[model samples]
Target: MRVLLVGAGGVGTAVTRIAARRSFLTHMVVADYDLARAEAAVAALGEQGTRFSARRLDASDQDAVRTALVDERCDVLLNATDPRFVMPLFEAALAAGTHYMDMAMSLSAPHATAPYEECGVKLGDEQFAQAAAWEASDRMALVGMGVEPGLSDVFARYAAEELFDEIEEIGVRDGANLTVEGYDFAPSFSIWTTIEECLNPPVVYEKDRGWFTTAPFSEPEVFEFPEGIGPVECVNVEHEEVLLIPRWVDARRVTFKYGLGDDFIAKLKTLHELGLDATAKVAVPGPDGPVQVSPRDVVAACLPDPATLGDRMTGKTCAGTWVKGTKDGSAREVYLYHVVDNEWSMREYGSQAVVWQTALNPVIALELMATGAWKGSGVLGPEALPPRPFLDLLGAYDSPWGLREER
Candidate 1:
C-alpha cells in the first residue's frame, strides 16, 4: 500500500525504517517542515528499486497536507507530527479519504497548561465526529497509537481480557537512561514535547476521579523491572496512558511513571522551584521591542537535541505496564514490558529505543486497519484494540510482550 508519513523527526525516521523493513509499504512518501531532513531520511532508507520520495510540507497547513495526500494518492496517512498538529492532519486525511493513524491524541497547543477538564472542553468534538465519518466510509482511524499510550494500553487490555476478571490498578512505567558517559543532557523524544510534559502538573486517575500531581521527576521511587533491565529509579510523570486508559476500562486507579536519572531529576526539580518550567510569558528586552518569552521555550532551546543522542547513547530503556488486582477471588499482579537497547537501535534504525518503540506501533496499527484486523469508529486508544495482534507483531520484532504472574 502507498503510505504518506508526515514529520521526519526522530520518531518519524525510525518509523520509516521499520516500515521499509517490513515491506508493508509498496510506495512511500515522507514529508517534513525541514526539507533537508526529509530528504536525508529518504536517502537513508535506500530501498533498492523501491518507490520512495521526500517532500517539504507544513502539516499544520491543511491545504498543503491535502495537496500532498491527493498528489501521492496514498492509501494511508501516518501522522508523526507534533501532537499540536494532529487534528488538522486528521482532517486532511478525512478530506483525502484515506485511513488515518497517529501516535498521540490531538492536543490544542504544544504548551497548553490547563487541567484536563479545561483542555478537554477546548479540544471539542470535531475530531471525533470526523473519525466517525471515516468509520462510516469504512476507513479506520486510531488515536494515541504510540508505545506508552499505545502498547501499554494494549497490555492493560490483554490483562483485563485474559489475565484478570477485574483490574483494579494499572501503572504504566517508562524508564530510559538516555545519558551516556560524555553527554550532559538528552531527552528521549522531542525536546519540546518532553519539556511540556515536565512543566505541566501530572494528571492521573484514581477511583474514577481525576487529579493532578507535581511536575516531572517530582515523586521518585525505585522500581525493579524484569530480568536484564534491572532496578531503576522512576518518578511520577504525565503521559497519555494516565489520561486515556481510565475511560476505556473500569479501574480503581491508573497512573504513569517515568524513570529518570538522579542528575536529570535534580535539574528538573531546580527548574520547577525556580519557576523556569512555566509556560506563561515573561518580558524580555529586545533590540527594537519588548519580547515575551515563555520559560518552556527558553529551556527547550537550551536542551540538547534528542535526535543526536542516538550515536553516543548507551543503555536500554525499559517500558511496560503493571496491573494489580484480584481474579478468581485471589490477589494477582501482572507485569507486561519491553526492554530496548539504545546502541542496538542505532545500529538498526539510526535512532534510539524511545523513538523506535513510539514509531513502530503506528505502522502496525495501520497494517491492521488496512487488513480489516482493526476497524472501528470514533476516538480510541491502544487499549481499545485487540492486544493479540499487537502482541504478535511486537514479538515478530523481538520486542515481545512479557507476562508475569504475581501472587
Candidate 2:
C-alpha cells in the first residue's frame, strides 16, 4: 500500500524504518514543514522495495494536503505531526479518501500562557463534531495511536475482555529514565507536546458518568514493577486512555499516571510554579516589531532537542496498564506490560525506547488496515480493536503483552 507520512521527527523516523522492514509499503513519502528533515529521514531508511520520497507540507493548508494526497495516490495518511494539527490532517485525509492515523489527541497551540481549563471548554463541542463527521465518512481515521494512549488503551481493554469479569479501577503507568551524557534534560517526545500535557489539567473518568478534572501532578504514587526496573514514583497526567476506556468497556474509575525520575519531576514542578508552561502569549519589546511569546515556546527552544539525545541514552522504559476488578465474587488484579531498553532501541533503530514504542503502533495499524484485519470506516482509536489482534501483532515485533495476577 502507498503511505504518506506527515512529520519527520524521531517517532516519524522510527515508524518509517519499521514500515520499510515489514515490506508492506509499496511507495513511502515523508513530508514535513522542514524539507531537509524529510530528506534526511528518507536517506537514512535505505530501503530497496519501498520507493521513498520527501516533500514539504504545511498540514494546516488543506488545499496543499489534498493536492499531495491526489498527486501521491496515497492509500493511507499517517499523521505524526504536532497534536495541534491532528484535526486538520484528519480533515484533509477524509477529503482525499485516505485512511488516517495519529499518535495523540488534537490539542491547542501556543504554550504556557493560556489556562488549560479555558482551552478545554472551548474545544469540547467542536472536537465531538469533528469526530461525528469522520464517523459518518467512508474513510477510517484512528486517533491517539501512540504507546501510552494507543497500546495502553488496548492493554486495558484486553484485561476487561479476557482477564476481569468486572473491572473496578484501571491505571496506566509510563515510566522511563533516559540519561544522555551531555544534555541536562530532554523529553521523550516533542518538547512542545510534552509541555502541553504536563501543564494541562488532567481529566479522569468517573463511574456511571463523564470526566472530572484533577490538577496536573496532583495525585502522586509509587508503583513496584516485577524486575529489571525498580519501583518508580508516578503522578496523574492527562492521557487519552483515561477518557477512552470508559467508552469502550465498563470501568468504574479510570486514570492515567506517568513516572519520571525525581530529578525530572523536580524540574517540572519548578517550571509549573514559575508559570513558564502556560500556552498564552505575553508581549515583549523587539527591534523589528512587538514580540509575543509563550513560556512553553521559550522553554522548548532552550532545551536540548529530544531527537539529539538518542546517542547518549542509556536506560529502560516499562510502561503498561494495571487493572483491578472482581471475578466470581472475588477481587483480582492483572497487569499487562512491556519493557524496552534505551540502549537496545538505539542499537536497532537509532531511537530511544519511548520513541520506539510510540512509533511502532501506526505501522502495525497500517498493515492491519491493509489486510482488512483492522479495517473500518470511521474515526476510532487502537482500543476500539479487539485486544487479541493488536496484542498478537505487537508481540510479533518483540513487544509482547504479559499478564500477571496480583495477590
* C-alpha root-mean-square deviation, each candidate: 3.3, 2.9
Query: Among these predicted structures, which one has the highest TM-score?
Result: 2
lDDT string, candidate 1, 1-407, tens digits: 88889999888888778877775568879899999998898888775325678999998899889889999989878888877788789988888878777876654332255453333321213565565577666666777788877888888888888888878899998776556557566676776676556555565678745644544455677877775677788877667787667767778888888776677767877887888877689999999988999887788778766777777777787778989988898889988887788877888778877788788788788777767788676566777878888788887776676776655
| Model 1 misplacement above 4 A | 108-138, 207-219, 272-298
Write model 2 residue lDDT over 98-143, tens digit each, in one string: 8888888766332244443322442222344576666677677777
How big is the positional error of residue 234 in model 1, measured in Å on the Cα after superposition? 2.5
Alpha-carbon shift of residue 68 in model 1 (angstroms): 1.3
TM-scores of all predicted structures: 0.88, 0.92
Q: Number of backbone collisions per candidate, in order? A: 0, 9
Model 2 spans with C-alpha error above 4 angstroms = 108-127, 282-292
lDDT of each: 0.76, 0.78
Candidate 1, residue 154: Cα displacement in angstroms equals 1.0
Model 1 residue 110 CA deviation (Å) reads: 13
After TM-score superposition, the amount by which residue 89's alpha carbon in candidate 2 deviates from its true location, in angstroms, is 0.8
